[model samples]
Target chain A: MSTPADTMKSGPRGRSRGTRTVIAVLYAVAVPVVLIVAWLIWAGVSPQIFFPSPIAIAEAFVNTWLGPSLTNDVIPSLARLGVAIVLAITIGIAAGTVIGLTPWLRELLEPVLEFFRAIPPPVLIPVFTLLMGITTSMKLAVIVAGAFWPVLLNTIDGVRSTDSVMTETAQSFRLTRAERLRYLVLPSAAPRIMTGVRQTLSIALIMMVISEMFNTSSGLGYRIVYFQRNYLIAEMWSGIVLLGLVGVFLAAVFTFVERRVLRWYHGIKETERA
Target chain B: MTTVATAPERRRRRLSGSTAALGILGLFTIGALLEVLPRIGVLNRRFFPPSSEILTTLIEQLGEGAFWTAVSDTLRGWAIGLTIAMVLGIAVGVIIGSVPFLRDVTSSTIEFLRPIPSVALIPLVVLLYGTKLQSALILIVYAAFWQVLVQVLYGVADVDPVVRDTARSYRFSRWTQLRQVVWPTALPYVMTGFRLAAAVALILQVTAELVIGVPGLGRNLGVAQSSGAVSLTYALVVAVGIIGIAINLFARALERRILNWHPSVRRDVAR
Candidate 1:
């Protein structure tokens, strides 16, 4: 597979690097500019109950993020995500390693894992809330449940894909199971496992928000719904924007970590360029 | 020859029987536990509600017109939004993927936009279009489009150069070349994209309803939960899960039928 750098070099190169840089900056600015202009025009022409102008939303965003009143909401949502992701990665990797290492265990458990994964995690929120109650535990439980399967599945796949020659060489050297796993399997699987973690991070964030929206008294999700209920349109929009930014930030962080950890993976390097 | 065939048939029958028996036993065990635990006070009956109660409520909800209305509304939005998304996404993706310059130019923009969760856009959508079908459709479109576009782009870009060269040498028109050479080569990836989009559409459908107060299964779930009808809420949640599973199964079956010629399905069949 050709890398993005190679493609860029080979492709028709009419535009200079400086021109491309300018285009990239303009493209980045265009979306928000268009949105703001549209919002201003719409708010000017017709005032409605739920439609807030860009200026109003900006003011509201400052208040929500900077002010003490709503900062706790962001903290709760972030805290839930942080705790859930930590638990998910730790437990998922351990279980996945065990299952992936043993052929018999994998064969026996694959069906059950697939079934549970197929059942959408959000649909289980009600049951989770019932079992755990609408506390931080419930929120964390839902996020963990939702995020676990992807990482686990990917890790198993990665381990299973380890080169047979490497395993045989380790076996010929009389390497113990633990040593073989530690030296050979985990490194081979790390990139794929990281990919799974990247996928799960977004899902984890989504579930964190949804769980809060379902039952919690505070959080970004709750604040958005709360403000909407009270017809605080600007505040609601601000909350929505912050949630989007949070999603972007989390995804960026995951990608950055993945690149650093799996520097050998060519696809990651290509993706960075893209 | 007769004896050999008979013995193999008998062994196969025995294996299938054991598999079926095991599956049934597992299902029954779960069902019984879910039923008996709450009654025995090991599980909380108030919030958890017995499996039998959930079944009864499911039946009751199914009989009501409101349930059907919600289903239809959800399906309508999901189908319309997904179809539009697929059509436009595949078109744009193929064009960009085929043209190296455009793909390079837009790659950054696509990456930036793709990570923004479609659900997070509900407030902006509601602000622009209010709690209308348009807003719901927009959200679904946003969710479904990116998944398909990314897959389609990769698929188109990955098409075999040999096939393209052959098509060009045969003096095929641009449209003919695309139809004969590009699309068929990319069909498997396109199907995978559609499958991913289907799951995304359902999620967005329910989410849109939950957040925007649109009339769908999610709205019904929200109402039931808020009203303290814990049993009904649980039942509805299960119903939605079943719907999602059914949609997935249907898509998988369609994919198998369409891609029967592909090596992946052939390998599975051989196994």
Candidate 2:
């Protein structure tokens, strides 16, 4: 099957370098410029409550988010997100690989996993609060659960789809089950596992915010909701904007990491070395 | 070794048809253990009620008219939000992806908007729509939109340029080229987007209901929990879980049927 990254290579390129740059600059700023203009017009014309202008938002961004709130709220949120992501990826890949190797185990767990997975993580806030209180542990628990399924499921699929030829080669060699899994299975499944991790990143971010928003304090989620509840509209907008920036940064980081990790896969495909 | 019946036993273990029974058995064992655990005081009965009691509550819920109302509301939110997302996602994703200039222009915006966790917008959405159905719609749509949009963008980007040039050489109209050349190549991605958006939409719908106090199963679960109705809360949660399984199975079935021509689907079929 063809991969998306493969399309970039060996495909026709139709633009000059200067034109490409012009297009890039124009395209990059178009939405922001248009949205700012629209915002200015809306704020100028109506002057309604809770509708802060773009300038108000910018100030709100710096004033509210630039100080202790950045350390107190934003740092905690990002920290929780980081922990949840690492936790999910470790458990998901391990469990998924183990189960995928034992196909019957995967099947036996299907109905069970699907049922549990479908229970939206938000619905557990009250339960978690009742049991674990609004502590960091409770938040981490929900975040891990929320971010886990994609990685686990994708890993299972990836491992199961490892080529029969690869499996046979391992069998023909004097490799133990552990060796086969570590050497043959994992390397073959890395691409799909990475895809799953990318999916998990977004879910972890959402879970981080939602878990914080519900009956909690000391995170961007709590801070954002706190601002809104107190009629601090500008501050709330700023928090949301900050949250957006955090997401962009995380995604950019993920793509860069993914490119590095997947470099070998791409390199082999491009050069037909495989 | 299964004594002298090793071959047959091995076949039964390996086959999905027989493994399905094992799956059912596993579920029953887990259910029985859950029923026993709370009663035995292994788990806190106050918070983690027995499975049987939860099942009783589930049965009672099914007989109640309000339960169905909440269920319908949840489904409605999922349907409407997913529809809006698919339409907008496909339209914008295709346009931006096809036009190289537009792709470059909108890349930053899409990257920025796509990752802004939808749950973070609960505050802004609540302010705009105020715990209404529209509030739920706003969250669900925003959350699911990115799933479909990204997939559609990839789909459009993956279109082979040779076919595109052929269409142009034949003087095929833009609309015709899109329908004939682009749609087929992108259909698989669209289906993928649909499945993903469907799941995300449901998750966000429940979330909106739970967090924003909207009218759905999630809201009912929240009420049940706060009122100290432990068994009922578990029951409602189980109901949501069942609904999720149903949706997933339905989506997989649809994908298999729709994408029969695709190699992955064919591979699954052959297996």
Candidate 3:
């Protein structure tokens, strides 16, 4: 159960600094270098349909992302993600708090939540399509349904983990139920709640893409599907790379926000105290 | 006073078990109601099929040869991809986690690559491998690999120093040390990663078929839905849900059996 900080303290060093430096450099340069070399080698040999080349992909990326043809795809996808996440956080936290605060409510709700959580969101995409039709609303609804469970379950766990003593103190001090929830429970649950938010973000992204792929006409997912159907290999690869870049950016932002928001829960502080 | 205390305790025990049962019952009741309401015209039947029809369709599909064919094809891709992912993921994760410099250097890259949804790679895969089983397997591998790798890294990194020191004191060979000490300590995390990977593998399997038309349950579901066999589509969706649940339950059972000594499982058993 040693914290990551403790591992840093006592683990073997073994030229780790030099190794890290080499790894960093390789990661930064290796992908583009390898891709370019592969393109060149393929171009020299056959190049008809076997390879699309790195430069082709780059040009495709610029046209798709920078130029005005279908760049708005990214925005709609982002907007769906934004709506889903906001709904997930707000509803998830509210419902989780009520259930966590009351044992009877938890007992009544836990099984239903578990059943829904077990069902994959992709399975529900067609059903949503039927209900809402193949529109942006359907896509957003799918994202919301997919993202809701993780955040809700995590929030419940976070609230349950709140100190009983603190709860009792609030009671003794005659704090109203709402006041106690706002002042004590929410603050204590914030770290775990954030973790839930992180999980929801990933799920939301997946559903957003899946819904678009299955039913929609305009998002990044549709673009990927559309390009594939037309046999535009370069355009398709460009979309994939763009999506990967988007994933990386979102994950980085999540990690940064998580660290800043959950500063008090940092492993370094825990290890230092220990 | 003693009788009163004992009565409350007994009631509490009864309540715990009954509450769980009640929760499950409540969920099913709601589902049943939803099914019935649509049939009765209280809810729209066109949008939502009746529960009886969904069940009948599910049973009929299960009996069909095409359904089994779809199941086997999907399972083939899932099994091959998951096997490869597990082996490579664990090996790479262990190497990276055990070697500090490697871990630090690869951390950023891993994080960068981790968020790319495996389904997003479907287009590139189709282009490279063509619209076939390989495309589906590639997507499954991509989906499952990162999950297993991250968990394996955490597992290796979590190995207790006291155990490592004890092994060292015994002058155990490196292989022996790793086999006896590191592997056991990391087994729980690796298993957890496998469980998570299983879910991802199933999802990716279906997604690949749906997007690429790769002859699986997903393709069947898509076909059924598009052809306006609404009941059949719902039935297939339910079948997929059951498969997912079965995989999860099997993983949990396996974990409990394998990690009987682990504190979490031990506590559950004691309860």
Candidate 4:
């Protein structure tokens, strides 16, 4: 079978690198510039409640994140996101390694894992709420359950794909079992493991919002719903915008960390391209 | 679960002959534990019902017209939203991707907005459409749209300029050129995008139904939990899982059938 890199989806960058910089700098402003002008026109034609001018949204954005809403809502929401991702990575990796080592175990759990993976995670919210109550841990559990599969699947693939030659060499040297895993198994798998982490992180974030939406208080999702129900349209928009920004921020951080972790792998790809 | 029959191993373990049996036995053990643990007081039977009870609820649900209606409502959102996304995505992708300036300008904007979770829009959707079917459609369409759009952008970006210029010099009509040149190149990417979006749309449909209290299987799931129908809740969950699996399998089959002429399929055949 071909490696993932062979079939990896790559966005065409451009025709040439030289012409990209100048046109790119100017073109960068095109979307925001058009959107802002359209927003102005929309706000002008509409009432304050429905359209809520860009200025109003900016104010509400600050008010929501920096004002009393910060401690009451934003912090708690971020905290849940952090906790869920951490739990997802920890448990997913550990369980994935065991399955990887035992190929039969991997086959045994395939259907069960696929079932959990496919379930619209929010559907599990009601069951979790019933079993665990509407608390922070309950919220985290939903997020973890939703986030776990990608990491575990990737980790298993990573572990299973560890090079036979490398393992044989380690055996020839009579490396200790723990040493073989630490030095040989993990290093080869690191790139794929990071691939899984990236997928799981985004999933964890999505689940965090979904879990908060049901039977809860003091989180981004709850506050967004709360403001809408209360008819605070601008504030609702602010929360929505904030969530978008937070999503982008988290993704950027994940990409940065992934690039750092897989620098050697990426370098190899870059050299091959060159 | 283990869908394929394994080739016999050259270096076989003592228990290798019984591995398939072992996996089936493991599944039964899990089912038995689900039944026994709650009744034995190891788990709370009130909240966590036995497997048999859940299966019975699932069978009863199949007999109810309301359950079928709910399933149809969920499916309607999935179908309508996926269709809209595909149409809009291909159009926007072609328009934006054909122009270098447009692609460069919109890339950052798309990247910024795409990561925003569809659930985050519950408030915005609720504000606009309430718990109506439109609310579910809006969420489903918006979430799935990005998947198709991005893939199409990549597809268009991949169209070789040399081939494009060669066609231009031959004075090929714009429509013919697009049909012969662009469509074939983009077909695989479009199929990939469609499959991804199909799965995503169903997920968002369920999420919208549950979160917005829309009339669907997810809403039914919510009702079961709220009313303390523990067995029915588990049964509904199992039902949803089955639907998810069915959707994935259906999409995969469709993709494979259509792309049979592609090199990817040829490679698989060679293997």
Candidate 5:
């Protein structure tokens, strides 16, 4: 149905490219719209408590999230995520750089670092809760503990891979230690560090939700669980939707930052591909 | 001649041996510190029990039938969920990738759905299935399916257009073309997807159990923590950590076996 012969018979080659773009966009938009309509129809017909209509979800979403829940639940969760992300990145890079630069230390610490990395991240929540209690600091500790490893391990690997020639050149040029670090090391390791940071962001989110799932907390996770336990089905659905939005929002923001930071890396990759 | 050939090899062996020794020494140092810190009141003994106590507690857990059952439950959920996700992912990915119109139609939808983390569905699943294995299964499968699907799609799209056209011109039967061409090209990607999905499936499995109170090691961990069994909690955490490492090693080994012919795997093996 999509053969070149069929398209040639239908129209001229140059015009076909423009029409094809239009068709592709049309198909992309139409599919999701049709699915939503189908969902709306089914949701209307059945109308069960568990399966709330999209309209009901939308209304519940506004009532639950667009009010005090913003301050109490959403803000606290985002705040923890923001703080943990900063702590994880800073600690991971600082530690990773030092260890990576020292051959003996890297060898000594590799297994221990791996063991920490291999720990199923959520398991830390229980241990942290016991040690720190279910407070904000406890939540931050949980998120950072889980999120730190990827960045740390990745940074170590990245730093170790920094070109020896560049370091030698900097030394021969009598560059200051800080200048060598700033110019020769971090930029070279930036791409791998960004990869780790990307992973850390997602892990941080997962840990945030998980840490909130435990005792005494106002968070997106807790709110959703609270709604479920209380049989507020629509509100629960709304809370899940809000969580999804947060994930999407975070990913979008990351993509923007990654593009800016990795522009040089992308340029190099493009040239290499060419 | 023998001395010359073996000189570099001997040095390499010695270097590796020294590294291994250093690694073990590091482990011992940490262990000693952990054991001493609590005893000397540098760290709270209640919160950070000595390493020896935790190890003893772990040995104690190894004897318990319920512990094994919980471990098995987690493994079972992970296996079943990963299998379902792989099957559905490969089947759907192949179909979508083979059709240009379908791929274009679904690309945006897939992107939109992919970023919505599967853990977000925990509430809905809990509402539907309560704290059962089925609730956890929903989360595991949801997270894992996308991992496999995205990889399979990339693999299928990577099939060479010239090779496909040549096969079409030869009138190779669809089944034969798929078997000889598509499957071979897609197998490496499938292996990569399987590895990723394996990790995701385990994470989601543990998360669901821990959060939803399902019957798994994760739930056991929660039970231990809440009951104030401090040493037992550390023991369970260590057990789960070991399990995670084991799963990772198993996935890598399986990937190597399945993708032995793949250039990446071959290069890795050669190295």
Candidate 6:
């Protein structure tokens, strides 16, 4: 996790550091541009139907996604992902806390929890569809089911690993269960909880696309498949581009949120390492 | 500190008689509840078959050739995909990590592409290959490759600078330097990546099959759902779950064996 600046400090003894950094930045910028240009050239040369020119994809991207599909497909997908994330965080934290705090409960339910965790959450999509019949609710259920496990499992480990001294100190103060959880246990587990949340974000995004792929009309996943089935090759490629953009956006947001939430944890780790 | 972190988990793994008994009891309680809920009409009978019925259905599936074929199909996709990804990832990661300039050049592009969910490529894959195993392989490889590559890159970056400089001063051949100085440091990270990629490969394998109608347990599960064979779908899910657990156990054991010389594994053994 060392910064590029840190690495550069120990970099080979050579030309000026400033020049090296500028060169590094230029290379970083050049690589992706070069790759895209190469793709464009390849597309223009072969002219395969499946491999549309980058220009054609760009046009299709604006025409297809910047229009009604933005509201119809993209917005709904993001909303479902957003809602499922919230629900997963709440349910996972609640259930995980209960399981984590009680020794007997943790021991008793470990096998059952392991069984469920082992079941790749994707397989539950059909079952959820059958039970709820291809509704938004079912999609939400699919996503939340998939996204919650990391949160739940991490929360259990985090809560269980709370320092024994800290727990005893809280007990000596006669803190009620609610008070202890609020001020002591929860704060101690916040870093791990944030780790879970980070994982949940990606899982939620994946599940959002997945839940839409099955028997649904208006989402990014459906639109992409729809375009493909109709042989709108350019449009399908554009849909994928949009999905990638959304993924990048989610990752950037998660980084921002993690920095804010785990600021103290990072500070502590720095001092401990030093 | 590492031993302290792992001690409780190791103890938990070697479950006491009472804890093991309670765990099994807890599993039965869930099973019994699953059986009772549908029978008592709390859950719909059609969608949520009783546990006994699902167990019987699973047993029936074990005797069927189609079931074994689906299982083998899924495993084939997962294995092939994982092998390709690991090879590509390690090779690319090592080459990139060794050259600071190359690492800097590729970092941004890799970051940009890595987060794009592999499922997003379903449309493109389905278009190019239809429902073939290649479609599933593309998705699985795409998803798993980044996991390994990123970890390996970090591992390479962690190579001790003192040792690297000494190797250079000694005028060791490039291959000798890499083999002697870099590979050992990176092996632990590669193992971490392998474990991660295995799980991801399986998930993507099942996903491609389910969504794209590729031949696998996921395809069977989907077909069962559509056909209203609810118990059969549940059985397929259980079978997939077992496979997942087996893969996980295998990965962990492999990691321990391969990294026995590493401090992380050595510490556990000492404990």
- Which DockQ values do the candidates obtain, in the order shown? 0.23, 0.45, 0.37, 0.44, 0.45, 0.62
CA RMSD of all predictions: 6.6, 5.7, 5.8, 5.5, 5.3, 2.8
The window of 10 residues in a row where model 2 chain A has the poorest summed lDDT is: A3-12
Q: What's each prediction's TM-score?
A: 0.82, 0.89, 0.87, 0.89, 0.91, 0.94
- Residue lDDT tens for model 3, A174-236: 999889888899988887788778778777887788788886678888888899889888888
| Model 6 whole-model lDDT (C-alpha atoms) | 0.88
Interface RMSD of each: 5.8, 5.1, 5.1, 5.9, 5.3, 2.8
The DockQ score of candidate 4 comes to 0.44
Q: What is the lDDT of residue B215 in candidate 2?
A: 95
**DockQ measured for candidate 2:** 0.45
Q: Give the Cα lDDT of each candidate.
A: 0.78, 0.82, 0.79, 0.80, 0.84, 0.88
> Which candidate wins on TM-score?
6
What fraction of the true interface contacts does model 1 reproduce?
0.21
lDDT of 2 by residue, B11-99 (tens): 23445676778788779978999999999999999888889999999999999999999999999989999999999999988887777
True contacts kept of 2: 0.68
Q: What would the TM-score be for candidate 5 when compared with the true structure?
A: 0.91
- Which of candidates 2 and 5 reaches a greater TM-score? 5
Off by over 4 Å in 6: A1-27, A174-176, B1-14
Pairwise lDDT winner, candidates 1 and 6:
6
Residue ranges of candidate 2 with Cα displaced over 4 Å: A1-26, A45-48, A176-179, A269-274, B1-15, B260-271
**Candidate 6 residue lDDT tens string, A1-274:** 4545356544556777788787667866898899889999998788898889899999999999989988988888888888899999999999999999998999888888878887888898998988889888989899999889988987887888899999999999999999999998888888888877877887788889988888888898999989999999999999899999888998888889888877888899889866
Q: Write the residue-wise lDDT of candidate 3 on B1-271 in tens digits.
A: 1111122232234346778687877777777987889978997888688878899999988899989999888878888989999998999998888776567657766777889877788777777777689998888888799999998998887787788888889999988988998898888888878877887888888878876788888888888888888889888888877777777677767766888797755655466
Model 3 ranges with Cα > 4 A deviation: A1-51, A267-273, B1-16
TM-score of structure candidate 3:
0.87
lDDT of 1 by residue, A18-75 (tens): 8767766765566557767988999989976676778898999998777875558887
How does model 1 score by TM-score?
Answer: 0.82
Q: Which of the predicted structures, 4 or 6, would earn the higher TM-score when compared with the native?
A: 6
lDDT pick, better of 2 and 6: 6
Give the worst 10-residue stretch by lDDT in candidate 4 chain A: A2-11
